[model samples]
Target: MQAVDHVTLATNNGAIGGGEVMLLRIAEALRELSVEVTVVAPATPGGVAEAAKKAGFETVQLHVKNRLSWMWQLRRWDAKHRKGVLWCNGLVPATATWGHRDRIVHLHQHPDGLHRVLSALSRVGAVATLVPSAHMLRSVPGARVMPNWTALMPRSERSPGPDAPFTVGFLGRLGPDKGVHVLAQAMRLLDEQDPGRYRLALAGEPVFVAKSKVEQVEQALAEVDALVDRVGWVRPSEFFDTIDLLVVPSVWEEPFGLVAAEAMSAQVPVVVSDAGALPEIVGSETGMVTPKGDAPALAEKIARIASGNEGVDVAVQHARWAENYSPTAGVVRVRELLDTLGA
Candidate 1:
């Protein structure tokens, strides 16, 4: 057996978003494979510390915010806990765990500038590096592509709501880079073409800033032709039930669009940008894909699905998701990687 005595997972677990959920799932999965998992995260808002205790894992909530504090914590970890493997979520923790080069580094984002420099350094020092897509592979040499997975909701719920104002749901953080402006533009375009046919549901929090950021997003929404219902940050369990069609118009090059996979698992059709890993997430046979930042194309596709002119088989879409991103397959792949690491 490989001498992986302990596994430390460092991530920003603020309990406000999906990253925390991903970290928890990964930790649980690793534990099931007989690895001693320890999650070292930022302190959460609620009783998550107690919850982690109930789940039978040790959690160290170091209240480290900025670079200087993080670096101090890293120096401390390096000095004390010198054995075991370290798997970090993103740049901050990855660099923090840099002193332990013999372990693996699984990078979640396609970093830029200084972060990119750190990632390259990690690649040179680590045993293996994991990324989510081919687009991300260009940023990190020899990085193995492993798509993100989720505990899927039932597929029957993917169908559009039969008795509502034709709803187009925009789910995900309402940050500037999340392409909320593009979604707003598309809603405007669609409302102009068919005033009574389409309505929008904006779900998730404004991650760009605090109170001012939400006000900015609200002001941006005012420019749109219609008013949208804003449902702030939702749990993964509650996602598919609240929407008809999930539209992800990401402006940036996302390493892996987990929203697409989440929607697909429910057998719902998605309208997403052609940028980054979106096309790979929502395969052509399953959902409608348009060019990045093209509001008109987004509107056109939304109109096609809303009007039922383009007969979208949501069941077929769910089948495509089942074929590829099932939790069973993901665990199997992870186990194989573990074996390879041992060998």
Candidate 2:
């Protein structure tokens, strides 16, 4: 490892996504500990570099035609000019800068097939190979867990009425992989059991989802159209205020259930599926869980919870636990990681 004068954070995307969001948060964390940071991203989409500058860091935009071009350009730039430890925010940057020493390879998602091989190659001579959750260790066994954290809401704005229909909320992409279809199916079953007893408030859209996938999910949700309130993209606080509880029914394995954690922070009860790190985030006592893609089981569970107002009794208590993912705790964790890395 070289001297710890500063850290240069390389983003995985030209535009901002979940990994890019964490890159900014990590920069903030490092700056809090008195480490200088310079953010690097592609010039085409040009989001991450611009955002880093706004966050009070130096920024570098690699001129490129596309994502693949930006990657190799980043490698050349780092190899020729950059100093200090390189922090790769995802597999792209990590693989690009693998030959360099004193670098941290952070995997935001568990890769499979060809990507799995790339992940292995990205680990050579790294300070650490990091993943966002313990569940990821099942696939990336050699990586260390670097749990993602979130910004806490000031106070819970939840005020759903007791007499009103039990409102279930979801706050991610409205695609099948997120189990939007499964949720719709469950809501339909609940309606059959007790008509007008339950409803859904969806706070997201199919931004990155393919057109065909979106059509399938929409078709499945058509049966429950009247019961569904599509609220598009919204702030977590605003979304939490309009519902009695939040549901994160991801069908694919989740690297981290950040939305579930955000719901907990806002004093909203959560119903998560047993998919990847979701259960790890909500835990057994703080929230309820059902089998992934099982509409009947999910409907039965939601029915019991909606039948009474007792489901949210642990809301406040869960909010207390959610503080573990707060910025202050994130700073502490970052400090510990850096110290262990001898930075």
RMSD to the hidden true structure, all candidates: 3.0, 1.8
Model 2, residue pairs in steric clash: none
What is the C-alpha local distance difference test score of candidate 1?
Answer: 0.72
Which segments of candidate 2 are over 4 A away from where they belong? 285-287, 313-323
Query: How do the residues 36-72 of candidate 1 rate in per-residue lDDT, one tens digit apiece?
Result: 8787655535344445566888877666666568656
lDDT of 1 at 169: 83
lDDT of 1 at 194: 71
Highest lDDT: give the candidate number. 2
TM-score of structure candidate 2: 0.95
lDDT of 2: 0.86
Residue-wise C-alpha lDDT for candidate 2, range 142-220, written one tens digit per residue: 7888888888754455566666898999999889999999999999998998888888999888988999999999999
